[model samples]
Target chain A: MSTTTEAPQVKETTKTVDFKTIIDIKDMDLYYGTYHALKKVNLTIPEKAVTAFIGPSGCGKSTLLRTLNRMNDMIPNTRIEGLVDIAGTDIYSNEVDVETLRKKVGMVFQQANPFPKSIYDNVAYGPRLHGIKNKAQLDEIVEQSLKQAALWNEVKDFLKRSAFSLSGGQQQRLCIARALAVNPEILLMDEATSALDPISTLKIEELTQELKNKYTIVMVTHNMHQAARISDQTVFFLNGEVVEFDQTDKLFSNPSDKRTEDYITGRFG
Target chain B: MNNLFQDANRQQISGRRRNDLIWRILFLGATLFGIVALSALIITIVTDGIARLNPDLFTNYPSRRASASGMKSAIVGSLYMLCLMAPISFVLGVGAAIYLEEYAPKNRFTRLIQLNISTLAGVPSIVYGILGLAIFVRTFGLERSLLSGALTMTLLVLPIIIVASQEAIRAVPRARRDASFALGATKWQTVSRSVLPSAISAIMTGVILALSRAIGETAPLIIIGAATYVAFLPESLFDTFTVMPIQIYNWIARPQEAFQDLAASGIIVLMIMLVIMNVAAIMLRNKYQKNI
Candidate 1:
């Protein structure tokens, strides 16, 4: 089979990859010092599906997304309460090694932050960190990842070129390729395309449709249309609380909560 | 409706413009003051030393007779002291910077340490000479050898390198660390592979500038007893030595008119080294700026 995963293979891969609840969160609360960032949050993310967290600014959407991979641990005085289980294990437990946890759950940021390195090196960085020293193995992983991220065709000739040479959109895809080279089961995107132009945002949206066939994707987006367009499930948050959660079409077409409806239909956010 | 194009307060507008020009001229004068002073100094040194720049000045050791005296030992001493001091200062300075910036908790203790480092960077160089006296010279019993002198120079430059390194490290975008950690890299791995590489050029630029300062330093070495009239080269780190600045100081202090000329020649050599280092720093930054 070609290294580039095609959309037609989604059904076959879903059966093998266990398209079930990969993430289980219950009564989760996050506090940045005295300020409560995420309160009484409960969410379950299934494997091999796209879940988008949508809300206005400072509504705890990004905070909730960060809790999945524990990236919020980087902040000072960030305290967490309640259970966050991923793949049937409490990620915040003392026994869980954060490095290994992050390897399984990759992340891409709002900015397309490629290292000041050659494109090939950026893609191979993750695998190298996990001790993949064999040159041939790294080459194959880099090739497959770049292909999967839809960046291989444009960059195949100059893998030696610095990643900064790529355009903003291409650099974002390179970051995705870097994330995928480690073979992560879950991918977290924190406003990953908010920095891009319309065309670039559309390209990332299309790439997400193709990516959910293999990896569980959790995204935080300010654009409600983006949630409706790409996500299988949509979550709407308001002021550190989850106001509504439903299937994408159902939530956009007919939200159960008045606040969600008001926010979605050009009402006060 | 009010007129859109014409301005009403003609006098006020011209008055504001005049103040702007006045400020600009004042700033220009301030800048020219620095430039004029530096050019005058350089011109004086070049004229005084240009004739003394012969091969013998670099080839022979100091002699009692002004005509025969050369700067071989002092020149070699400064170079060797730099070689010894550079690595020691680099590791200690950058290590402390990394620890403070990356790993240290934002507590009162770390804040105190940060304040101390800032204060040390401003302390008089002669004070560092006193520190070297009590610590390296007397307590350690290292004596006034090349090693002691090097250790003293390291102390003098450590604060500068550390502050510069810290600033460089802080300037590394938070995005770089986020990208690394999201890939499951450990703290050491992320710092070594991503953050350090991004900050390397800036840190190196700072380190080179600090070393240039250390090279021209005289008061500290004098207080630490760097030797004079040294006719022999050091065989090892523990041997007695004298640097160019010390040699030049002794030369200028002498009553003979000829020694002043030799001092000018020594200043020329020292200035050349500093210029080369600063240029190297700029080149290093330009080379790495494009990569990021």
Candidate 2:
């Protein structure tokens, strides 16, 4: 069901906007040692929307996601140039605390990487780190986040059980709950559901939809169908460059670039 | 064609015969050598030492006369030395290992430290003895006391402890660290809360094995001047000490036939202690392996 039509250019209009841009990345370049992983890239992520980055492996989708939270700073010989501003503050600025920036910008990995701890402890870890000491407060957050993840029912009885003892799908949802418990304004997910079965993937996709009402989400996924099914805005990346970015409907049904069209149709990676 | 076929068959038969004969000889020779060596050592020790084994060996203190003597003093002294040495060595070694494995950046200095530790592990026991004599005994004024010997032995096996502990800590999968960090824990928090607990058994195994090695060391204690004929048990860390190996050495060095018997008995005791330590290490290692 391919449809090719030019996106209608908007006429000049003026209105008062209430929402703010949560993340503003401009001219961002990332290098692993001497290899340029992400060429100069730029994007503005709006608040409270599911923004999906779709690309083949090694195209720098994950790199861009990591840079949003300064997670790449952990790797030795990894260097970034250009600006990544979150909430009007440059995350790369010398005065900004990396831990505080990370606290506000939570991340989930490709694999379900729950800590080798109790489910309750795993969910409570983030809040505890940011100096939440009240037992009642942490308990409330853990229960609320788990419920939001649609995992509270399955795991509530076994809250004290090890996170590792959960099923793969359960573990992934637990990780999501953990990220949510911290109350981050922006959530960065790097192929969060790529390792789960289709049923679990659907659950996470649904949860992502529910979460976007409160938190802005930027996810990297290789699955085109997943991007189309879950995301509001889709950015198609190829060879460390943004090939096409539009509404999900437009990007999938009426891709403007030949490369995006080919990738979407499974003609080539 | 007939000639070629015959020649091929003959060569094949000869090669097969040679191969079979060589394989048979090698297998039989290895088995025979292993059995002979093990039996000879066991029989020699048991036959010579079994006569000295008695209840008093564990109950009474050492004496000048063989008929009145027991290994109680040496046993107590060895236990006390282990008590002091194990904790000291474990703390120093594990701390060094954690710094090297988790925090220390890869640089020329760390590389040099790592290399030096490996080389030190290979240094002869006697050299450690001399160093202990010159340093702990003289400079520290420990005066050939149990503390001096323990300190010397600690240095002797410190490298082994560090190496083993490093391996254990490194064995903890990187995913654990990533998980902890993603949860917003700091580096030390990640290590102490997650990595160290998972690696505890492996670290313990290393510590116990090193301690076992230290317990059996005779040269260092002898060089540090452990007394041979102490009638009283050591009352303090500064008191002169004699370990099982040193006592056994003293016994074996005597011309009296009875003293040689005492040496054999001491060998049995030392062997039993070593076996117990090794078994504990193996158990700890297995427990962690199952969990991880």
Candidate 3:
């Protein structure tokens, strides 16, 4: 891993932390028009691990997540500086294709957004777009994705039913299945369980735990407990800057930064 | 409660109830007036046309003899014109709407174009007839024909369809497009596969309504020189034709009482055609709404 220089406190904190880095953000800054949304944010997300971004509202956690897949490029008058490297390749490089980058990095939104199609079609949508047309192959992929997302048994009998017929939690899982159908390497969930009931939230947390074994997962969450429960590394953000980044257990138990402790202790956010 | 407060409250409640009753009755009378007027019109038309309703109305061509007068050519002409106008306007209007809503940059130019379209929708139908006369008839040398008349109606209703379709396209939530994009679907695939399907029922409803208006229009057709009397149906796009409105107008102008009755019968047929078209539109909307 490349050494993250100074703030002597961060260096002292990282001495006990160890992981194989897969995504490295080096002195990154992002602006939406005149608004500086992220300011010299540096982070290293590890492979096959769940990294959680915990921050108050409007802290730019979601903005940083979107930048990973170049989704920020869709917004008008948005600009980025410095490097965002995924798997040792600079994603913002001129040669990178946004479509191919998105194909490798899947995202789930705060609200479940399933297409207004059949349950089977929802999972099969991504594969179909990439030119997978064989019926048997599509069927296999659909079943595998839904099963992987843990939505197959409930929906397998009625694959032709409209996706809207499913509950909100089921719809979110279907969206997960849809993303997985594309065979992405990294999964980004931006408060994916914030809209769900506690039971559904637990189910998704469990799914995320299972999914992290195969796919590198990064999630931005409002629930600190969720981050504590699922993440291997926890990054605390405040005011468009990273306040703390350490092992999840270490950060919660012995936070290095005062702001991180204050925010996490329900003192102020 | 204090006696004074109770008295005041009771007085206010009774006064408000009295005012509410008066307004309710007034609104009910207004609604009844429209329904009663419409029922009277239908009764009058049905009664007047009942004697003229026969197999001859559908089979025989218009003639000087009132007994032999029929709307065969007019019916065929209207249907053929509708077939041409519906598809043409739907394709053109929806295409323009999609471009404006999905692809066009939001700028002063786009706002100006949108304002122009809204203004165009409110322009007099006869103004479009005059335009058709200058462009399709004189400039293009098409003369007074079915093609010219259909083209005029198409222009007359095109603005309405475009405006309605733009609203429909705009109504599709951005999340659907985002989902499609995140899945690596190209812009075209996202539109055709998701956006269009979601907005289609509304677009079809708008197109069908515009076509209904086109079917009933007479001022533009007359301005474009559609035939008032045609014994034979239009054999080709270039052939002269007469619509039900034009045929009815011709009958109502004559001094003969029998011809006036025939006009009443023609009105009934036109109303039936409109009802059928609207029912089809409603059915299409409901069918697609279920899927969406």
Candidate 4:
């Protein structure tokens, strides 16, 4: 598809070789009342790789990301058609409890919305929701989740401190730890670091790199460079349609679609 | 002309300052008007009733002799009624708020119900008294006992607590609920653990204010037949009761000047009870806010 232009750069992406598909979305269409938000979308996400969805504002990348965990169901009058099969089961089916689905597919929001609680309680909130009430077990999960989110060192000493006491960056990471505390199979991040400063963004990107080794990560980002730096696969979306989905370096260096090239190169979004 | 703020007309600025001073004084006067009125009332009551503030006020029952009469029965009865009415109103009101805010879907029916509740909060307390008369006193055969009067007071204040609780619950940021729900907490869990905890202090403040209004109420209890000159304290829910307001009202109606002075002493007692309730609520609010 990039027949005319010579490829400029290729970052090594050798790890995508053994990726096993864990999420298969087919013929998926999402509608909010009268307006169709996502149309005829098909995607297969690897089990333990960071797949970033990149698009302009209102381009349905975030909409698609929300559909992955049915977070969009919170919106009234929303409808979904076709299949979103996670680990070989349709998440939208009647038998699938929405709460359990959310527990398994944890999410971190754009704004770091930690509960008005202690740092330990914010992390332990998830485990307690699933009925893990033993103090020792909760303490261990809190420690492990905070460590996984790279926030243990900053907050471990003051575990009883209010979550709002943390700086914005630390709070965002605390939210990440909160999501990870549930021990989810997939972590959906909807512009999770966009609210933070550049240094915090880098920290979250680095955290994502380490986190993808264990959990399948789906992230929606307005920052193309963030997608390039952290994602193994990049899905470029335009007007609710998948314009191009490919390995991150391949798409950035030599996009098959002209629109993808324009958006990535900052010619126009 | 080069400086965009060129020559701001010093004379005009001075004139504006004079006008601003007038408005400032006006607002200050408006604020002081309320304080002055209240202070004058307290001064009058204190000067009139200071002699009645002796140990005799606590121990003596109502008597034909003005100096010997005390509010012992009224105080005990009022306290007992508050203790009875408070729990019932709090549970019903807060429960109604939780249902409307968390569980009930927003629809025309719920909007109508909410509208009615708001209107009920503004309706005269006398109307609630009448309702209590027809229902609790007559239909239920409870008569004009403390239970009937307490239930009427509950009815009078229930709308207030519900409205205030709804406001408190609504004031909680939606993000907090979202945070809880995202962690796989059920709707009830989210509301109880997250939403309620954040709103409890504000809700308590509202409850205290509502109860304060209930405590000062005279007409509802009067309509429910609170005996104005009870010699013995109310012993049970079904026992005849007379509250402080009714006691004070009865004294004020007497032609005797000493009885009027006694009424002022009763007024002081009522005000003290109110101040205590408000102070306790503020302390609880501060404690809870700092606890988090």
Candidate 5:
């Protein structure tokens, strides 16, 4: 029965796309203890594009995003099965170091989780860990990362002040700057701006648009308008299955699935 | 209908007033009970121990002559004990607390260890005295030396230090831990840089409080065979020793008025030391809390 349903769908999806895949996921199933959180799923995240995962809460979009960086390995009794290839390297292989993977694929969380340190120190932390020790070099990296995150102007005067002293939006930007300082190739954001007010959300979305030019971005957002506005590609997920994967403009305008159309039209999630 | 409503409202107001009176009475009664108990303790200590305060109390060594003897030897002995015990106990206890609180897995063994430490904290000081006697004095053949006494005191107060340090470490939020780890820090790096700094103030406060308790402990020292009379101060860890509590106990046991006055002076000294330690702990805790 499983083979009967999966054969045609595999054939249908393969025929439509030919993109340079940065991350190739195949037959991935995830479980939180005994509860099946993510069903057998396959996806190909394209290189140098803003790919957004839009789904309701508990739809496994964030879980899937974390899998790209092996962040799910930290959780106890969480099991993952299948192949996840990052740049033709199987990230799940025994030889792959999670630390190196995490360094290459940076993550930003739902809330702004800045270190309880000065703003300069927060940005310099990642670089310092990778053995960049010269003070002048660290300072240069901090400035460039902050500027890239669009937070340099506001925090330039108070680089020595505690990161906790910043406003919410500034703190979020500081967190982004911290991730960028490590010079990762890919950035995964899990509801990165959901905790912020609408203005901050808009700012983060604008920053996301600018960031895709340098780093491949895979973002999980509940905001449909956000997915429509910022993402170059959109993958709609439901019940741990991909409802539709298409260009953001095409998915929002002409959703082929009834569920995707209903979701985009503000029906039940 | 309006008249009925007004009558009900009047009843409700009177009922609330009666309830408030009852609550106020209960609260005042509880406050008075606590005050009376505290006053009784202070009065007993002051009346019994104050008269002993005199110049001779710090001048002469312990002797049979109640009028002439002092606790100079015992004071030296206790100072020596503090010098030996404070650093060793603080390091071991705080290290154990940090390991248990931050690194230990939530397994049955860790839970058992936690429960055992808490139970040890509540155990009578005399039991620790007995343990010290068996382990340090008899088994090791240290034989009523200052080292044995200090080791015993260290054991007696260790649980308190561990509990205090754990509370301090726990007060640091998990968000701090996540932030540190997210910056590519290893577990040890995260704990050392972020968690320990935030927890240091609380840990120091706990150590100071534990040391105060250790200084006041008489039962454990006595059980471990602390001398009541020593002619000279202990010059080494192995030298025979006496502490402030032992000296006071010796003086109070005598049936002479002059000796009782000496005991009161010793009590005054001990109380002053305790107050100073407590004030220092509070100041350190506040300073660190503000910095964090």
Candidate 6:
């Protein structure tokens, strides 16, 4: 559940009681070619809540996040074991379409990669591929997605300009807008703010808090403060396995596991 | 003792510096040798051909009389061959590159195919001439027509186009493809919408360079039995043809002294056509580059 904030006290009060399990992972294991990338991991993600995955480098947080939408399928010789179900549907089942899964679970990457295209085209790319051809509808989606990412006021007049013309922070926000344009139910952020400056990183954390009301959000972060500030639930990972899963405040204040406590206190990674 | 060691080190340094100076002068001489040879060849060609450069070169067809002979049919025929070869090579070459770079699994078979393509680019044009003669010219019964010659040239330059295009496609960043795929795009959608657009300028540059090689090719056309004296323009794809190189070769072979100037003039025209083609390619590449 989200912690209390003065400005949104009423909204925060309402959000704490309405939580439902949306993603259920049971004994999930993943491998890349013959190397195990993720060990047996089990967790439940609540709908319309922000979850953060915090760990050291090479701890498999990003790998586990990618498996949520089957993005790991793109890698050659990658194998997954056990179940990862979203809304009661097993995503690893043969009948499950990876593309459709990805549409429902949008992802933003560590590096902000705006296609070498106009801003309008970058946002419209997802919808256009999903078969929306109407100019008016595309324009509406582009406008709404940009406004949601808090980038519309800066980019509205020059929609036709190339996306690369923007600064790094703007480009990362543009990537978020691009992911939102598809109307996904879940958003995955894989170190999305690690490439930005402190100010840009703060802006993204604020955005995550605002976005959690409408979408289930999972973020992988090296910055523990950002995770504590934004996420409602926190999962600590170590050596491809989860060390602890608890409410954000409890995990930060009184971690149940010694490793989690060490990591949180900067004793050792 | 320290002074003696220092003196030895300084002696070694001076010796190495002298060796470096010698190698630098030797390398400079080698480069100048090549440049001097090339400039001499250019000067000879220009002096020989400048007086004979006339409008008749574009208006009249080939003739036994050196004064009357012009490169009309040969110029038109080479252009026709280029027009036919460019599209065929671009589609097949770029498609194969995309498949190899984007879709093919990383296995032994793909590696072998890539190795063979690199090897094929090194194979002589004359060998391709033999292959064309055995296949398109005889087996398909197309004979020495424009279509047969174009097909042969396509095979000759196909390897170069494929290799260059593969390099271009491979140069595209992995991040772009990941971003596209993360947005629910299928494989082809990611390639065509994102990857291809970013690499198109490089692809165009490669294709144009390949097409230029195809335009100047003579061995394959000769082996395919393209007629040396086709007076009329090729009205159809099946019509017999002779490209610029073959025409210039014929002129150079003639015993008459005047024919040498005529050959030089043909060379000039051929070079001009190549320049024009390259310029057009650069313009197209620039337009696509701006979009990316």
C-alpha DockQ for predicted model 4 = 0.69
Q: How well does model 3 score by local distance difference test?
A: 0.93
Q: Which digits, one per residue and each the tens of the lDDT, describe model 2 over residues B1-292?
A: 6676665677789999999999999999999999999889878889988887889888877787888889888999999999999999999999999999999988899999999999999999999999999999999999979899899999998999999999989988886776667666788878887789888898999899999999999898889898977777899889987889888988899999998888888999999899999999999889876654
Candidate 6 segments exceeding 4 Å error: A1-14, B1-31
TM-score of 5: 0.88
Native-referenced Cα lDDT, model 2: 0.87
Candidate 4 chain A, run of 10 with poorest lDDT: A5-14
Per-prediction DockQ, in order?
0.76, 0.39, 0.70, 0.69, 0.33, 0.78
Instruction: Identify the CAPRI category of the predicted complex in candidate 5.
Output: acceptable
Per-model C-alpha lDDT, please?
0.92, 0.87, 0.93, 0.92, 0.87, 0.92
Give the per-residue lDDT digits (tens) of candidate 6, residues A17-88. 567889999999999988988899999988999999999999999999999978888888999998999999
Q: Rank the candidates by DockQ, best first.
A: 6, 1, 3, 4, 2, 5
Candidate 4: where is the Cα deviation over 4 Å? A1-14, B1-8
Between candidates 4 and 5, the lDDT winner: 4
Task: Give model 2's DockQ, 2 decimals.
Answer: 0.39
Tens digits of per-residue lDDT for model 3, A1-269: 23665677576357435557999999999999999999999999998889999999999999999999888888989999999999989999988888888889999989999988999898889999999999999999999999989999999999999999999999999999999999999999999999999999999999998998889999999999999999989999988998889889999999999999999899987
Model 4, span A1-269: residue lDDT tens: 23454442221234467688999999999999999989999988998999999998999999998887787888889999999999999999988998898899999999999888899999999999999999999999999999999999998899999998999999999999999999999999999998999999999999998999899999999998899988999999999988889889899999999999999999987
Model 2 chain A — which ten-residue stretch has the worst lDDT? A8-17
Fnat of candidate 6, please? 0.79
CAPRI-style docking class of model 3 based on DockQ: medium
* TM-score of chain A considered alone, across all candidate predictions: 0.93, 0.91, 0.93, 0.94, 0.91, 0.95
Comparing candidate 2 with candidate 4, which one achieves the higher DockQ? 4
* Best model number under TM-score: 4
lDDT, candidate 3, at B45: 97
Error of 2 at B216 (Å): 0.9
Cand. 1 Cα-lDDT: 0.92
lDDT of 1 by residue, A158-211 (tens): 999999999999999999999999999999999999999999999999999899
lDDT of 5 by residue, A157-204 (tens): 999998889989889999889989989889989889999999998899
In model 5, the runs with Cα more than 4 Å from the true position are: A1-19, B1-5, B43-60, B66-68
In candidate 4, how many Å is residue A179 off? 1.0
